[model samples]
Target: MTSYNAQEHHLTSTTCLPKPGVLIIVVEDDTDTAHLYQTILATRYHHVAVCHSGSEAVARLVSHQGPAVVVLDYHLPDMTGIEVMATCRDLEHPVACMMVSADRLNDQEAGCGEAIRLTKPLGCQTLLQWTAKLVHKVQTAVHGEGPGDHAPENLLIGQSAAMQHLRTLIPRLAQSRSPLWLHGESGTGKELAARSVHYCSPRSSGPFVAVNCAAFPEALIESMLFGHVKGAFSGATRDHKGFFEAADQGTLFLDEVGDMPLPFQAKLLRALQTGTITPVGSTRDVRVDCRVITACHRDLAQSVREGAFREDLYYRLNVLSLALPPLRERQGDALMLADHLLESLAREERIAVCPLDEEARNWIQQHDWPGNVRELENRLRRALLLCDGKAITVNNLMLNDDERLTSAPPPSQAPSGVGIHFSPGRMTLRQIEDAAIEATLEACDGCIERAARQLGVAASTLHRRRRRQAA
Candidate 1:
């Protein structure tokens, strides 16, 4: 391998021209492609090198003296792209590489580099954009600025009392090493809460691994959690590290924990108590230290009573528990979250920002939101993609007034036997609309023309309004 001296490669002077200190090594066997890349990078960066094989790339990486970024092709003449990355890793050099390939292959195993798959005729603009991003990322890392420094703002957005309460508890939760058990209906931001805890904790520098217990097959749940050794069972070709071991010194989020098999729960309990795990078909125990965070839509307490869950394991995971209130109970948070989702979608899709109409806002508040935050997100995403105007109407959300009316208790059945008693302080505008629509429909015997006349509006206008309300 070719190696360069670092001391001799230092920048000697600073002038108006771009510094030639940043070294870029390109590994492309295709002569035309290599020349094209060299020309493209020459326009912006000053230092660039091209190698035709993985062997040559590895040699240059070991010998390089200054800061360098490597752009490697997935297919190399001497070895695979991943093999070249392994060589750079073995040398212990701080080289950031981007893997360029036309095939959908695993780039992670090849080395720690960004993976960009392009067709035979790659666009120059796309190539430059990827190169710029990779270079900037390497520069940031070299400056000792971690990835967390550039984390997106407002990861959890809301100002409702429930949200404010959660905000206050997150930092405190992060300080503790105990396993956190999160309970809430699906789509209520349980995953977001888990992420907040990880990002704010002392182990923020470490990896955050997430697994969904419900998604795993019942027969494979144990192997997935504790891992398996080579030949441990059928299809066990190689030894593997489980989530517990993978998340060492970091956070392991177990979503849908209630769905884990009862037998696996017993094994997990032992691991939690002893801080050790034994892979399948292995007698030796491996010690692991990781923060466990579990979430579930079902009530664990109920599951324990019914014998579907292990009582001992439940207690261990419940050491630090946080219950996320349903979206309907979060009051004004629905609107705030909707606005945030809409803005985010707009930015990501490069579309114009679409505001929710008053009627639509009312519909959002009135709905029960059985799917919680997830349902709201899906609705907004669909509206953004499907809406034709500047404002997202109730119709765009695909909700009906009847569904909203059915979710609320009848006004006459209020606790005081007079006015309705909607939770979270008072009834929202959506609730009011629901009530009005219900009463009007009853008065007009569901006659569209009669209802319009009774409500003092044009028939066509009322029909459109009704459709919007129903949606």
Candidate 2:
């Protein structure tokens, strides 16, 4: 009986109509309301059935042929709507259910289930829109069509073996309700991977709430995660639903989870264990049902060993883990991703897709993308904007020499560390800069690109500085 708040969910769509073949069953005890629903839906759908009792609806649903969606009233003549839905769970043909009620239901009354629940006094348009969406969702699943927007394959884009393995692993992870741990470097698409898991799961229709653990202050972390009542603190003017409650009947993604304060780890562990949260300034605990997916760039096991994170909480969140490979580790993906990003950006910007020049491709292949996919995306976006109707050159990306040099050795070949010695004389700033740049270039086997990366400057910038010093 987890009621769907229309404002909260924002799931209104009227243009996307359901297919005529899908049957819609309206289960309302009130004949006038039932007639109104049947009349409205019958105008759009070929088959619309009305059932006044829970028993009748269950029998009809269990025996219904082809794809069907039922609108079940929370108060039925024989049984509660959830009970009806739960009983039909074993039906040979799956049916989508929407429970409508005048009375608001709490998470405890019904537990978080797959059925969508909406409060009564529901608008005719809202009812129709939700019913259509549900019908489309069921039919789409049954016919094996790709889901809208957040398809796992599209979200996790790459052809490398590592990516192929992830494509296989993500769906399997989605099938379970256990806590999921996504370990990856920054910009490695941990949140995207989490999203893939959510869209691929039974809870796709519900909210997918993401929280950045590091973004919240230490003092407010508890209240942000568990909510707060009115007048809880200074500036507490109203009751606030926290991340956990906001993500009920869906997924809660905690990104950069390693940065969560150690003291709060204990409370998080308790919430995960008990499936409940006690909001700030509230004495009673509210039950919540959501799949908790957590991501961190650093090693949690190491953090636990160093006592920065809780050992027990680590185990709790790490029930099932998926490690995303950084962009640098996924060989041959950099260029492929570059093309994809360019095309996507072009479409978004309403411009023609920009091609990468030979030098740009070489630089992309050679440079170490420490920021992973995010850095690549950012650089490509910048290049796309500045390329000015030309193929994107290394200069456009600001990562290579002004006069493009031969492809440099991969970053792995660059020296791990470069040491510079300043002559004992007090040197000007320009002299110091030149000495450091020379040392880095020498250490990188005279590869300007590698030297620039090491020196934290554009290869073109490094080349210009070196030439000026020589003159």
> Residues 1-471, candidate 2, lDDT per residue (tens digit)?
123344533333234455666778999989888887776676567789988865456545534535688898888765677766754443323478888889887754443545777887777677777887788766765675345658877998899999999999998899999999999898999988998999999998877776667654577778777987878876455676777887789898888889998888988999999999999899999999999999989888999999999999999999999999988678788889999999877864568888999878878876767789988987888789889979998878764563234344556656544576677678887788888888878877787767876665556577568779879
TM-score of 1: 0.58
Model 2, C-alpha of 462: deviation from truth (Å): 22
Report backbone clashes per prediction: 9, 0
| TM-score of every prediction relative to native | 0.58, 0.57
Question: Candidate 1's residue-wise lDDT over 44-80, tens digit each?
Answer: 6788888886545654553453457788888876567
Q: What lDDT score goes with residue 47 in model 2? A: 83
Evaluated against the true structure, the overall lDDT of model 1 is: 0.70
Candidate 2, position 208, lDDT: 75
